[model samples]
Target: MKFQIQRDRLVNGVNDVMKAVSSRTTIPILTGIKIMAHEEGVTLTGSDSDISIESFIPKEEDGKEIVNIQQAGGIVLQAKFFEGIVKKLPMDTVEIEVHSHLQTVIRSGKSEFNLNGLDVTEYPHLPQIEEDSVLKIETNLLKTIIRQTVFAVSTSETRPILTGVNWHIENGELNCVATDSHRLAMRKAPISGGNGDKSEAVIPGKSLNELNKILEDTSDELEIVITENQVLFKAKHVLFFSRLLEGNYPDTSRLVPAESKTSLTIGGKEFLQAIDRASLLAREERNNVVRLSISEEGGVEISSNTPEIGKVVEEIQRKSTDGEALNISFSAKYMMDALKVFEGAETNIQFTGAMRPFVLRTTSDDTILQLITPVRTY
Candidate 1:
């Protein structure tokens, strides 16, 4: 196989696919990237069994040639060395050629390097998803949904299922939810052509995080294909596939209370800053707990204390509150994460009681909701 490609174009393609490449894999071939040159363009694929990414660089896009393919074949090159070589190539173009014995040669203006290449045939094939059950949404909106919720997924592998985000589509709305049993983040958006029928899937948080980084926030629509065991995301010239988590996600609907006993509306920025300052003191504690007390005079007091570190106390004016004064303790880290995604000027936090889970959301927008389980502190 032989190809002469624009250096920058090749670099971008390599970087995008490298998100799926893992350096420590039992299968040695999985550590290499598969490069295939065809009549249409050049394709780069990286996979580690759990996730796979394929990026295509067409020969001509917008009437400009991006690659000039002299031979049509495929080769697998060590991802570590090939990525470094492509980035540091001191020329506008790169020349790559592979011999019958899988010896790869790379050349630039004044640099030449030879590396061992493996037969592309040994690489695992990516899952072929049918286009039957597909949903389309704006790329920007999809990224927003993932960003707001993926962070809440559990990093621990004990439960295994909690490490992935739950995706459910119904009534033309798509709901994405993630929780680590302590805090939950949920986002909802209208999906084009999505129906009321219930369809559910669980996708790894790691996969969604990588997808968010690669996707461009634009008005362009992305097609999502869902099957029993695999989920596929298709952008303009990129295809991302992830293996779905096997167990059933916990039913979280019942966890969100239908009504609240104590509700307070506060400025999102002010509340976030209060928590930030309070967490500084609580960081030394195991739970990083912070306390919130709603005053009868319509003000909220935020405070945190540690045995080794001094306490912090701050007050923020509230928009409105109902019922008796409420005092609650929760993880400051969870509160800060939930507040960062607030889209409006102020957010309404509804507390059922001092020990119950509280809900935080924009009063103006009903599409997003965040819930945090209170930390019990005597």
Candidate 2:
């Protein structure tokens, strides 16, 4: 295969596909990137069995040539060396050529590197997904959904199902929920162009995070297709595929409380700041626990204590307090994470009880909700 392409475009394509490449794979070929040059464009693919990413650079876009294909062929190059070489190329154009016996040469502006290329036939085949029913969502909105929910997925391998986010679609709305059993995050958004049928999939949080990093924040829509074992996301010039988790995701609907015994309305920034300061002392504790005390007279206080160290108490004013006065203890880290994504001027917190899970959301938006299971300190 021989191709001369714009160096910047090649760098971007290499970077995007490298997200799927892993050096620890059992298959040696998986450590390299598969490059194919065709009449239309150049395609780069990387995979490590669990996830696969493909990026295409068109030969001509907007009447400007991006790739000039001298010959149509394919080869696999070591991702580690190829990525580094492309990024440091001195010129705006790069040339790649393959000769007999799987030998490849890369040249750009007075610098040249020869890499041992693997046979393209040795690479594993990517899953072939049939796009019968496709779901479309805005690029930025999808990134937001992943960011808001993926963080709550369980990091422990004890319950493998909780390591992924549960995705369910009904009535053209997509609901994403993730939880580690201590904290839960849920987000809902309207989608378009599905089969008009109910659908559910459990996507691994790691894969979603990688996909989110590659996707640009834009209003352009991306197509999504779900199969029994795979979910595919297709954006302009890029295709991402992730294997679905095998087990059923636990039902999280019942975890949210029906009503609250204590409710407080406060500014999100102020609440976040207070929790941050209180966590400074709480970090030394086992669970980084912080205590919050609310009074019937609308007085709010956040405090934390460590026996060997010191105690921190901060009195923060609340906009309004209703229901019964209560004292609660929870992980300050969890509260701060929830507040960062809540994203509004006012935050509404509803507590079922001192030990029950509490819900946090913006007063203006009900679609995004964060729940934290409080800790019990006797």
The lDDT values for all models are 0.91, 0.95
Candidate 2 achieves a global lDDT of: 0.95
Count of backbone collisions in candidate 1: 1
For candidate 1, what is the lDDT? 0.91
CA displacement after TM-score superposition, residue 151 of candidate 1 (Å): 0.7
- Tell me the tens digit of each residue's lDDT in model 2 across 178-270: 999999999999999988999999999999999998998899999999999999999999999999999888889999999999999999999
- Ten residues in a row with the worst lDDT in model 2? 278-287
lDDT per residue for candidate 1 within 269-377, as digits (tens), equals 8888878888988864467899999877667899988877788888877788886788899998899999998843599999999999999999888899999999899
Off by over 4 Å in 1: 194-197
* Candidate with best lDDT: 2
lDDT (C-alpha) at residue 122 in model 1: 94
Task: Specify the poorest-scoring 10-residue window by lDDT in model 1.
Answer: 190-199
Give the lDDT of residue 59 in candidate 1. 95
Model 1 earns a TM-score of 0.97
